[model samples]
Target: MIAERTEQADLLAGLRPDQWDAPTLCEGWRVREVVAHLTMPFRASLGRTMLDLAKARGDFNRMADTTARHDALQLSAADLLACMRQNIDHRWKPPGGGTHGALAHQVIHGLDVTVGLGLDRRVPPERVALVLTGMKPRNIKFFGTELDGLQLQATDVNWTHGTGTPVRGSAQDLLLFVCGRRLPPGRLSGTESP
Candidate 1:
């Protein structure tokens, strides 16, 4: 979704100053905080990540939340968006994660804001595919839980994971599912929209 983010960032950059403080789906975080959080992960060196780990008590999500909370760039959403554009392609290694995992973070974070704001830009199909394919193994460690029991099958693409009853829909729907949105009544295991 790097390319899509480039396009998406352009849209975000143009948002009025007032919109930067808008609420996003990420609970208490505003759009500005989300942007700051996204920026904090780029090329985090061993030293910085270790500091984060200590701050998070070794939880990546906790670490990210902490960093975002403590980030100095809490003001000036325009500057944060500009930083996002500059760091859009920086390829964060996250101490021990793959580029695909970064792709997941990027797309999902994009959705957290876009979906919250009712924007129309979509994450690129290839980027989504890479994430869907990689989630099987990556999420085990990253999510600190089991996704094995969950069946994810995309309606708009040839995609499925796991083997039980399937939650199926367009790629975006599936992305929404993994991001923890409720499956639409008829979107799961069928072609009909809910």
Candidate 2:
């Protein structure tokens, strides 16, 4: 998680000021909102999270989305990056989720910005594999991946999962695809290759 956070910080550091307002794969969230979301755990205390949850009427997703939107308006790009860099080693985890979940959070959100921006940030193969292996049906559902009749095969790694129409690509690309982001076409090939 620390390594992933560091990689994200480095990427953000090189972003042009205009890029901060760029839209991300996360609907309604710009790059700055995504960064704010990434650093949210570091800034939001347990009590505050609970309060936000109440305000969201017990919807975790709503609480998260609303907080990210609110925080983005208050935080500068540089401050967001600094918070992420400083919290690289922070052990904060989601309710009932441990270290692996923390890694998934960082990796997926990192891809949210990089992949959405068309940047070449390849998450290390090992880290990608780690998250892939840990992915469960519930996780897939949470991310809204449409895998009911689709198989995902990674060309750059010895990993394959799911069934039906094959979706083949690099592990990182496959990860992004499974997380419900459509690549700009040609990055993933289906089994029948339409």
Which of the numbered candidates is closest to the native, going by highest lDDT?
A: 2
In angstroms, the error of model 2 at 34 is 0.5
Model 1, stretches more than 4 Å misplaced?
A: 42-46, 138-141, 144-150, 181-194
Question: What lDDT tens digits, residue by residue, belong to model 2 across residues 1-194?
Answer: 87888888998999999889999878788999999998999998889999999999999989999999999999999899899888888988877668888998889888889888989878998899999989888888887766778888998888999888778888988888778776767888883322
TM-score of each: 0.79, 0.95
Candidates' RMSD to native: 3.7, 2.0
Candidate 1's TM-score: 0.79
lDDT of 1 by residue, 1-194 (tens): 46866876888877877677787767677788788787776535679979888877888778877777666255477667778888767867444557776777777777778777777766766667777777755464443433455676886677877676666666765775666644336545633321
Checking candidate 2 for backbone clashes, the offending pairs are none
How far does residue 165 in candidate 2 sit from its true spot (Å)?
Answer: 2.0
Candidate 1, residue 5: CA error in Å? 3.1
By TM-score, the best candidate is 2
What C-alpha lDDT values do all the predictions have? 0.69, 0.86
Question: What's the residue-level lDDT of 101 in candidate 2?
Answer: 88
For residue 56, model 2's alpha carbon misses the true position, in angstroms, by 0.4
